[model samples]
Each structure stands twice: as C-alpha cells, then as structure tokens.
Target chain A: MKLHELTIHEASDLLKKREISSQELTRAVLDRIESVEKKVDAYITIAGETAVKQAELADREISRGNISPLTGIPVSVKDLICTKGLRTTCASKILENFTPQYDAFVIKKLKKAGAVIVGKTNMDEFAMGSSTENSGMKTTRNPWDLTCIPGGSSGGSAAAVAADMCLGSLGSDTGGSIRQPASHCGVVGMKPTYGRVSRFGLVAFASSLDQIGPLAKDVLDCALLMNAIAGYDPADSTSVPEDVPDYTSFSNKGLSGMTIGIPKEYNETKGLDPEVSGAVKNAVKVIEDLGAKCVEITLPHTKYAVAAYYVIAPSEASSNLARYDGVKYGFRDKEKNSLIDMYRSTRTKGFGAEVQRRIILGTYSLSSGYYDAYYKKASQVRTLIMEDFKNAFKSCDLILSPVAPTPAFKIGEKIDDPLTMYLSDIFTLSANLAGIPGISVPCGFSSAGLPIGLQLIGRHFEEKKILTAAYNFEQATDFHKQKPEI
Target chain B: MKITKDEVVYTADLARLDLSENSINRFADQIGDILEYVDTLNSVDTEGITPTSHAIFLSNAFREDEVKESMGADKALANAPEKEDGNFIVPKVINL
Candidate 1:
C-alpha cells in the first residue's frame, strides 16, 4: 500500500519495525494532500512544515522505544478545536485570523503521544449547518462524488480521512455533525458519550451536546484514536470523572452475546431512502449472522428529537456565541459610533446568514413570555428523549440504525431550505440528545455508488460496546475497505 | 406560529446583530417554519418531567482555589482585534 494509504495502526506497525520513517510517511501524506486538495477542499490550513518537524521529532522518540498507537501518525483536527499558534477559525470569517495561545486538552494529548498535526479541517460556520456548504471559506466536497457535500460541519475532517490526506482526523459532534459527515464520506466516525471526552477547548456550539471524537479509515483506527482522546480533565467541569478503558482492547471482541435493537420509529421514519433502509437491514442481518440478536425497540419520543434539538441547540448557541460582540478578540466593527452600535454592526458583518438566523431564532425562543413555550418545553422533551434511550438500553446492548436518512445529497440541494436540511439529521440527533456514544461505519453503497453508513449507538460511556460491535461488523464486511477513488 | 418581521428585528436587536430588510424578512419566514415544526413539543405530556438543562447529571466541579499561571497579558491580547497598552480597546462603554 502507498504510505498515505496506511491506517494509523498500519503505519504505527511499520514505524515500530523501522520499515518506514515518520518523515517519509508524513511527506507522502502531505504530497497526497497537495495533489488532491483542490479537488476535495478538505482542509482550511495545511501545516506542512510543522508536521514534518513533528514527524522528525516523533521518529527520534520512536527509535528510543517510546511508542504509542498514534505515535508519528498524521491526524487532522477540525478547525474548531484550539491549537496553539495555529489559526482555528471554526470555519467562520469572524475569527478568520484568530489563533489560540494554548492547546485544547485533546491537542495536548495528541502532541504528548507524538502524533503529527496535519492541519485544520473545514466545517459549517460555528458548526451551525448540516453541510459544509455553510463554511465561510470553502466548500468541502465528498471524495466519492465531487458534486455532493461531504456531510458536515465535520465534512472536511471526514473528507480528508476518506481521501487519505491524513490517516485519521478529530471532529466534534453537535447534532450529528461528525457521524453524518462520516456516513457521507464513508469513513469511521465515532462520537463518544458526552462528558467522556473533555470539552475544555472545543469552540462551544451547544455545550451540552458537543463531544470531540475521531474519524478514521476503519474502526480499529477509530478505536485507537478514542483510546488516546477519551479521558477526564479538570479543565472542563462537564467532563466525567470516569476511567477510560483501552478502546483498542475491544477491537477483536466478537458479537456473540450482544443484542442489537432496531428502533421501530427509525425503521418507519418518513422519507428514509430505500437504499439506506436496505443497507441498514443488511447490516443488522450481518450482525445477527455473527451470533447477535436483533430485536425491535421503540424510542417513543424519537419524533420529538429534531424539534427539541432545534430549540435546545440554538438556544445554547445564542448564549455561547454572545461572546463575539466586538469584544476582546475576533472581528470588530471599526466604524461604529457607540458600544451597542459596534456590537450590532460587527456581528452583522462578521456572522453569516445561517448564523444570524440561528441567533435570531435562539434569542426569540429564550425571550420573555416565550421561554416557557420554547426553551423550557424543549428541555422537558429532551428529558423524555433521554428517558426513552434509558428504557431502550434495558433490552439491548446497542441500537443499530442509519446515521442519516440517506447518503450525502448534492451540495446545494438542501442549503436553501434550512428546515429540510435539519430533517436530514433526524436519525442521528437523538444520540446527542440522549448523551450516548454513537458511531458510523460504512455498510453498503447506493446504486448511484454513494456510500451508506450503519449507525451503532450505546448507552452513555459505553463506547467500548459500540466500538466492539462496529469493529466486528467491519471485520465481516469489506465496505470500510472501499475508498473513494479520488 | 408565524414569526413576524418585527419579532425577528426585536430578536436581532437582543442578539446584538443588525439584519438587513431582506434578511429580516427571510429569517422571519424561515424561523417561523422551524418554530411551527418545533411546536410539536407542546403536545408532549411533560407535566411533571423536570427540565434537563444538561444530558448527564453533574455536580459543581470543585478544585483547589489556587493561584495558577494564566496566559499573561501579551498572550491573552495576542488575538485581540484592537488593543492599546496591552488592553483590549472597544467602543466607548460609558459617557461621562
């Protein structure tokens, strides 16, 4: 295989045996990125020089027998994660020139493990959209079909991994951002249980729902990345003080005793593409054939998830994003006459249409007299959704479903209709609402040759169970091995 | 659940944002559609269910109140859009 085509585990094995140097691997990946980036537009920044330097340093450490699964591997980070001295724009023009002075906890872990940081990948502006067409800088195309979106706001991360520009990438999931894009891009994307991974320096969208996870070429690589990134940190108060297992250890565990639940509501969801439904059913059959049981389950509140999420996510986003009002950092309106005028004008010019739309919706929802009807009511419904998951988990080890209603659509297909775009995430939003771990692994492809993904969701902090199941399915099917011919 | 343009304008003002007439109208329509959809939550019988502000139950994370090293003035002001004498400069907040 070409150096750039190697998964994190594959490259790590070669590096440990001295069969290849980190610099050679890093260079081949950089060369691949330089060759295909124009076609994919998967990255907002390419840290070529710094990555090579880091690779050299990793090689020195590897020779001394100090090795981890991710040592010397090239990994891309979503632009929202803070990286010291690197421009982290969150794909928003407002912070186009903003660079952090400190590293996010996850970045610190990556550096500590000797992983070379490839670059920052693109996303929806402040993670506000389902497709990366909302990116303020560039549109990230699906490597499978250049005309289609890569799914988003983690589109660039998924695309970069799918195109072999990097071995793996880190992406944050808020309302299906990572999994939907991973599904669209035909890579493995895992969102760990909320609070399982510290959100210390992730640029907040909806603080309660956002969790940083990995997108990789396969489930093992995803597991390895999870092992490195998941852990408690005092920096984020929401971070769970729980032990993070060696996720890699769960890779080879077969599905002999696991019971997978297929949510009846998901199966009966309206507008679900027949191709995706067929793929998910086929995936369930595969898991059953491997000695697992598939049972019908119902998350009765599933119908309310998207509705509740719209209110909850945006309400939190509006409050969190209020920090960017021509203040200490980011964009400022220099021509304003007063403080309030400057705040208004700076936000007007800095934020995009979708962002402004969300801010307005959120503000209206949280406004007096409407709070009880919108925000509070949505929170109560959110509790019901969480309870639904809690009840369903009693009968199953994990829930299996489609990640998105369908594979990636055309780039501009749903951009104009925000409501329709929001519905695309119907299948994936509940996991975030319930604060559970979920993963997307390629299962089949549509007749049009677009990739389809099977989503596996587990109870909160049950990443190992879902990863094991996904790894077993990956081992049984060749779907994940199929890469876009970019 | 029709969101009026006036409501959009009011919300925009509350959000410290300035929207053009076209944007205001478009948002009013778009947000109205979304609100209509989200209004489905009103039918759910949430009579006694406590509002879940967070997904997981977490208590206040306590730490030793210690003086720790922080990003110094220069580093903190590094990304400031406008700064003077190591302090972020903004539009006048008060008029004496």
Candidate 2:
C-alpha cells in the first residue's frame, strides 16, 4: 500500500518497527493532498510545513521507544478546533484570519501522542448547516463522485479520510455533522457520547449538543482516534468525570449476548431511500448472523427530533456566537462609528446567509414572549426524547438505523431549500438530542454508486459497546474496504 | 407560525446583525417555513416535564482561584482587529 493509504494502526506498526520514517509518510500524504486537493477541495488550510516539522518530531519520539498508536501518523482536524498559531476559521468569514493562542484539549492530546497534524478541513459555517455548501470557504466534493457533496459540516474531514489525504481525522458532531458526512463519504465516523470528550476549545455551536469525535477509514481507526481524544477535562464543566475506556481494546468478538434495537419509528420514517433501508436491514442480518439478537424498539419521539433540534441548537448558537462583536478578536466593521452600528455592520458583512438566518431564528425563539413556546417547549420535548432513549436502552444494548435518509446528494440539490436540507438529518439527530454515542459504518452502496451507512447508537458513555459491534460488522463485511477511486 | 418580515428585522436588530431589505424578505419566508416546521413540537405533550437545558447534568465546576499564567496581553490581542497599548480598541461605548 502507498504511504498515504495506511491506517493509523498500520502506520504505527511500521513506524515502531523502523520500517518507514514519519517524514516519508508525511511527505507522501502531502504530495497526495497537493495532487488531489483541487478535485476534492477538502481542506481550508494545508499545513505542509508544520506537518513536516511535526513528523520529524514524531520520528524522534518513535526512535526513543515513546510511540503511541497515533505516533507518526498524519491526521487532519476540522477547522473549528483551536490549534495554537494555526488559523481556525470554523469555516466562517468572521474568524477567517483568527489564529488561536492555545490548542484545544484534544489537539494537546494529539500533540502529546506524537500524531503529525496534517491541516484543517472545511465545514459548515459555525456548523450551522447539514451540507458543507454553507461553508464560507471552498466547496468539498465527494471523492466517489465529484459532482456530489461529501456530506457535511465535517465534509472535508470525511473526504480527506476517504480520499486518503490523511489516515484519520477529527471532526465535531452537532446534529450529525460528523456521522452524516462520514456516511456520505463512505468512511467510519463516531460521535462520542456528549461530555465523553471535552469541548474546552471547540468553537461552540450548541454547547449542550456539540461533541468532537473521529472520522477514519474504518472502525478500528475510529477506535484508535477515540482512545487518544476521549477524556475528562476540568476546563469544560460539561465534560463528564468518568473513566474513558481503552476504545482500541474492543476486538471483533462475534457480538454474543448483545441485543440490538431497531427503532420502529425510524423504520417508518418518511423519505428513507429504499437503498439505505436495504443496507441497514442487511447490516442487522449480518449482526444477527454473528450471534446478536435483534429486537424492535420504539423511540416514539423520534419524529420530533429535527424540530426540537432546530430550535434548541440555534437558541444555544445565538448565545455562544455573541462573542464575535467588534470589540475583541476576529473581523470588525471599520466604517461604523457607533458601537451598535459597528456590531451590526461587522456581523452583517462577516456572517453568511445561513448563519444570519440561524441568528435571527435563534433570537426570535429566545425572545421574551416566544421563549415559552419555542426554546422552553423544545427543551421540555428534549426531556421527553432523553427519556425515550433511556427507556429503549433497557431492552437493547445498541440501536440500529440508517445514518441518513439517502446517500450523498448533488452539491446544489438541497441548498436553496433549508427545510428540505434539515430533514436529511432526521435519522441522525435523535442521537444528539439524547446525548448518546453513535457511529456510522459503511454497509452498502446505492444503485447510483453512492455509499450508505448503518448507524449504531449506544447509551450515553457506552462507546465501547457500539465500537465493538461496529468492528465486528466491519470485520465481517468488505464495505469499508472499498475506497472511492478519487 | 408565519415569521413576518418585521419580526425578522426586529430579531436581526436584537442579534446585532444588519440584514439587507432583500435578505429580510428572504429570511422571513425561509424562517417562516422553518418555524412552521418546528411548530410540530407544539403537538408533543410536554406538560409537567422539566426542561432539560443540558444533556449531562453537573454541578458548578469549582477550583482554587489561584493566579495562573495567562495567555498574556500580546497573545490575547494578537488576533484583535484593532489593538493598542496592550488592549483591544473598539468603537466608543459611551457618549458623555
């Protein structure tokens, strides 16, 4: 295999044996990015020089027998995560030129493990949209079909992994940002349970719903990335003070004694493409064949997930994003003389249409009179949704469904219709609403030659159960082995 | 559930975002449709349920208030659009 094509574990093994230097691996990946970036547009900032420097450092660390599973492996990060001295735009024009003075807790962890930082990938502006077309930066195309979107907010990260621009990448999930894109891009993506991963320096969208996780070529790679990044941090109060398991230790043990739930509501969901449904059904059969018992369960509030999410996510987003006024860092409107005018003008010019729309929606929802009807009501329904997950987990260890209603759509297919675009995330949003861990694993391809994903959701902080199940399925099927011919 | 243009304009003002007349009309329609969709939540029986503001509940994170090394003025103001004398400069906040 080519150097850039190696998974994190594979590359780590080679690096530990002194069979290949980190420099050679990093260069090959950089060369691959340089060659295919125009076709994919998967990155906002390609840190070629820094990646080389980090690789050299990784080589030094490896020679001293200080190698971790991620040591000497090149990986990409979504643009939203703060990286010291590297520009972190969150794919928004407001913070386009802003560079963080400190690394995010996850970035610090990656650096400590000696992983080579490749570059920053593109996403929806402030992670506001399902498709990456909302990104203020360049468009990222699916490597499987250049005409299609690579699924989004984490579009660029998933595309980078699928196209072999990097071994594994970090992507944040807020309402299916990572998993949906990973599904569309035919890669493995996991949204660790909320509070399972610290969000100390993640550019916040919805503080309660956002969690940074991993996107990789397969389930094992996803597990390796999870092991390195998941832990409690005092900096984020929301981070649960629980022990993070050794995610990599979950081997493909045939899923015995496991009971998987298939939500009846999800099976009856509207707009579920037959191809996606077929793929998920096949995945369930595969799990059953591997000694797992499949049962039908109901998350009755599943239909309201998208509705509740739109209100709650935007409501929190408006508050979290209020820090972008002209007083401090990021863009400022120089023409405005008054403080309010500067704030208004700077935001008007700096934010994109989708972002402005969200701000308006959020503000309206949280407005004095409407708060009880919108934000508060949504929160109450959120309570109901959480209860539904709690109830369902009593009967099943994991919930299985299609990651998305359909496979990757064309670039401009749903951009103009925001409501239509929101419905695409129907299958994935409930997990976020309930703060459960979810993984998207490639199960099959559509008749149109696009990949479909099988989503496995576990109770909050039960990442090991889902990872083990996903690994067992991945081992049984060759779907993850099929790479997009970029 | 129809979001009027005036509401969009008013909310934009509240959010400190100035939108164009064209965008105002566009957002009014788009946001109207989205709000109408979100109105589906109105049908759910949520009475007597406590609102969940956060998924994972935790008490206030407390720590010793020790003076630690900060990022410093230089680094903090490094990305500021306008800065001088180790501070960020902005439009005058008060008019005497």
Candidate 3:
C-alpha cells in the first residue's frame, strides 16, 4: 500500500488510535518508492534510510505516549527547500552536490512537530520552468496522463501527490508553479500570502514573488499542514508577524453570505478553453445557490500581468543567480586555466539554454541605460496590477477564475515555443504579484477526462477564508471524489 | 524584424553562459519572436496610472542584526564540491 496517499487527518487518526505505527506508514511509502518511483520520475533524491530511522523514532515516541498532530505523517518537500545532511539540489546541475549544513526554518519547524519528511521532489532548475521538464535530471510526468506534463517548478510534488507517492507535499510558487500543477493534476494547492510563510532556505527565484505552500488532496488537509508551516519566522526578515488561527476549524463554515466576484476581464480567451469557461460559469451558479452573492467585477489590468511578470522575474533571477559563479561553490570547471574561462565553462556546462536566456535578458534590463526602460517600467506596471486586484476585492469577499486556459497539453507541445509556455500562467501570476492567497481545487472534468481547477483567491493572509470558500464549493460538487488511476 | 549574429554573441557574452553557434541561432529566432509579441504591451493606455512593484503594502521589513553561532569548520566544508584544508576552493577571480 502507498501510505503516502493517506490524508494527514487519516494518518493522524490511525496513529492516535494505535492502529498502525509511524514506522509502518513510513515503511509502506518506502516500499512504494522502491516499486513505482521509476515510472513517475517524481523525486530527485530519496532519503529512504534516514526517513525510516526518523519514523522509527516517531513510533517509539508514540509508544511512550508522546504525540503531536504531525507525529507520524510523512510529508514531501520541494527540493528547493534546504534539508540539513540531505543533498538539496534545486534540480540544477550547479547545485547537484551542495548539501546544506543546516535545516531551513520550515524544516526546523517540521522537525519540532514530529513530521517525517519522505524525500525532496524534483523541480525546474531553480524554479525556472513551467514544466519540471527544465529539471536537469529528467522531466516529471503527470500521474493522470503520463504523456502530458505535470505542471511545474513544482511538478514533482504534484505528480507525487496525485500518484499516491506522498500524501501531501510543499511547493514554492514564483509564478503559478504550485497552483497550476495542482490544477492540472486535479488536486488541491495553496499559494499563501507572500509573508505568511518564510523564505529563508528556499533557493531564490524571483525574491518578491516567491512563496512556499502546501499541495494536498482536500482543502482541510492543506489547512492542517499550513497550520504547522505558516506563521512568522525570525530567520526570514520578510516574514509577517500575525497570529495563525486554527484554519481547519474555520473550514466548516460554508459560504452562505459571502460575495464572490468573477472578473469579466478574465473572460478573454487568449487560450482559455470554452469548455473550461462553461464549467466555471456552472460553478458560479452552484456558489450562488449556496447563498453566496456572485457579482461581475472588472480587473482591467489583468492582461498585462504576464508581460510584466516575465520581465521582472527574469530581471531579479539574473541578479539572484549571480552567486553560482564557479568560484565559491556549486559546479566549477577545472579545464580552464583563467578565471573568466572557468566561470564561462562551468556555467555553460551547468545551466540549460532557457535559463541562460533569462539571465541575459535580466542582466540587459538591469544594466545602467536599460534599467529605466525595462526593469523600472515593469515595476510600475506591477503596481498597476496590484491596484487592480485591490479595487476588485472591494466589490467582493473573494475572486474566482479558471486556473488555466486548458488542461495539460502533450509533453513536447510548447517546448520549442517559449512564449506559448509563458502564456499559460496568465490567470495565476496576478495573485502572486498581489501577495494574496489563492487555492486551486479540482472543479470538474473536461470531456477529454482531464481535470479543471477553479481558483479561489482572497485577501492577504486570508487563507482560512479561501479554504472555507473552496471547501463549501467542494462539498457541493463531486469533483474531488475522482482520483487518477495510477 | 531580424537579429544579427553580432547581437547573439553580445547577449551570450553578457550572460557568461557559453553558447554554441547552433544554440545561438536557435535562441535568436525564438527570442526575436517573443520580443515581437511583447510589443503588444505598448498598445495599452496608461494615462496617469502609476506602475506598481510589490503586492503587499509594507514598506520596510528588515531583521535586527544579532550575533548567531556558526557551525564547526569541518561541517561547513563537508558539502563543498572542491575545498582546501578549511575553505572552499574556486577559480581565481582575477578578471572580476
């Protein structure tokens, strides 16, 4: 049995009731990894022996009658988060051998709660790609359809969760990495408010836009995981000081008097499937029937989010990735005698082409003369996008939209065309830019049998509200009941 | 709407990522296509609207400087790809 599929609530109940030891649950996952991991390409590295040892300790504690909510539950983390003593490669050749000597703040928190970390999931090289296809090792395939991509940067976590490799996983969303893959895989993913979770040990992508969140099967399970992971951290300077409420407790309050606004501006079809739109409209009717008021709202600057995000993200990335020079750490070339030769040689061999392109574009934008023209203007456009969201929220308690234009496309469909690949993030990027919470829950199935996600977005640090709304919608619909045949 | 080999070479040098002639040619074609598409951003009317950067409305978020303990020297150098007796070894930074 793949114990990784059991929800935190399920696993916690079993452990509390003494039905199964934490060691047994952890062993079951390790056995599944031995059998099914090769087909999914989901993990970069498996800490199997260490995980077993930790689970054994957890089992001993429970035998002594010591337990926490996460005492025995196995949680998967994105490779980008640092794990002390484990080889934490951000799915890049440069960091292939760089093991962090200290656990990240999030890891420290998880350890305190007695959660067993199974392994690190694969990702784009430093969270750069829309598909984990950009992983230096190999592309992660979707559990639902092996031929299609598992939406990426966080693709491995999504794939692992969907395939029963892990019950829940963490993903860092720079630009729709978590929610998009969750949308594609027919699971639940959350992008918490920017400062709600700390970013201390996560490999930096776009500093301002990056956020770490949970991907699980149900909204309540996600909230349970989020309760342990969220809240302020002194290690992360940007972490906000706010009291984290019991999110799982608030989820049962259905959306009776809530006002959900649908941005008519998002109704435009750059690539949105008509069938997906119809499903979203139908979902709105369901919400209205639940006593929530559905109103039409306008977020006129919605279209510009993608254009601004690409420019700003690359600009920040170009500067952030500068630390990978063959000098201090990561991959270094011995063949080159000179310093410049070594830098060029090491990076040339280490980084993929798409990564190189973004770095160059960013460096050019941030260069003296071009800074005002590209980077500055993009920042200004970013302000407009945030303002658009602020005004939209005034008209409603929450905003709802389709997660993407369509379901997962074939593996090689947009690989050659970079612009098309970037366009897929249009609906999700604005939420990140606005620093609000957005959840992608399974909405309905397309005629093609692929999953469609209805994105529920709320105000800053309002994760509970978003989860409640999504749960209410979920309870009314039977979409989350269907699981992929893996 | 065309790019020359010179621009590709310049971009490659600027990025410090070694690119073969074949990769350069492919990038120029793909990048040129994207640049043309992004030109659509110019059509929007901003008028008096100001451009935005950060989403959260916070101004300053800086941590107070405090002395923290450091790891033992041996543990620090354990994961370095190349290391000297106690420090990380790297290509000399003579040029930059």
Docking quality level of the chain pair in candidate 1: high
lDDT of 2: 0.92
How high is each candidate's TM-score?
Answer: 0.99, 0.99, 0.96
Model 1 agreement with the true structure over A28-112: per-residue lDDT tens digits: 9999999999999999999999999999999999999999988899999999999999999999989998999999999999999
What lDDT tens digits, residue by residue, belong to model 3 across residues A132-151?
A: 88888888998888888988
Name the runs in model 1 displaced over 4 angstroms.
Answer: A251-253
> Number of the top candidate by DockQ?
1
- Each model's lDDT comes to 0.92, 0.92, 0.84
Q: Which digits, one per residue and each the tens of the lDDT, describe model 2 over residues A1-486?
A: 899998888888899899999999999999999999999999999999999999999999888899999998999999999999999999998999999999999999999988989999999999888779999998999999999999988999999999999999999999999999999999999999999999998999999899999999989899999999999898898888898888989867699999999999987888999888999889989999999999999999989999999999999999998999967889898999998999999999999999988888998999999999999999999999999999999999999999999999999999999999999999889888888899999999999889999999998889999999999999999998888887
Q: What lDDT is reached at residue A327 by model 2?
A: 71
Please give the fraction of native interface contacts (Cα pairs under 8 Å between A and B) kept by each candidate: 0.93, 0.92, 0.57
Candidate 1, residue A315: lDDT? 92
| Cα error, candidate 1, residue A452 (Å) | 0.5
Candidate 2 chain A has its poorest 10 consecutive residues by lDDT at A244-253
Query: lDDT score, residue A215, model 2?
Result: 99
Which residue pairs does candidate 2 place in steric collision? none
Misplaced by over 4 Å in model 2 are: none
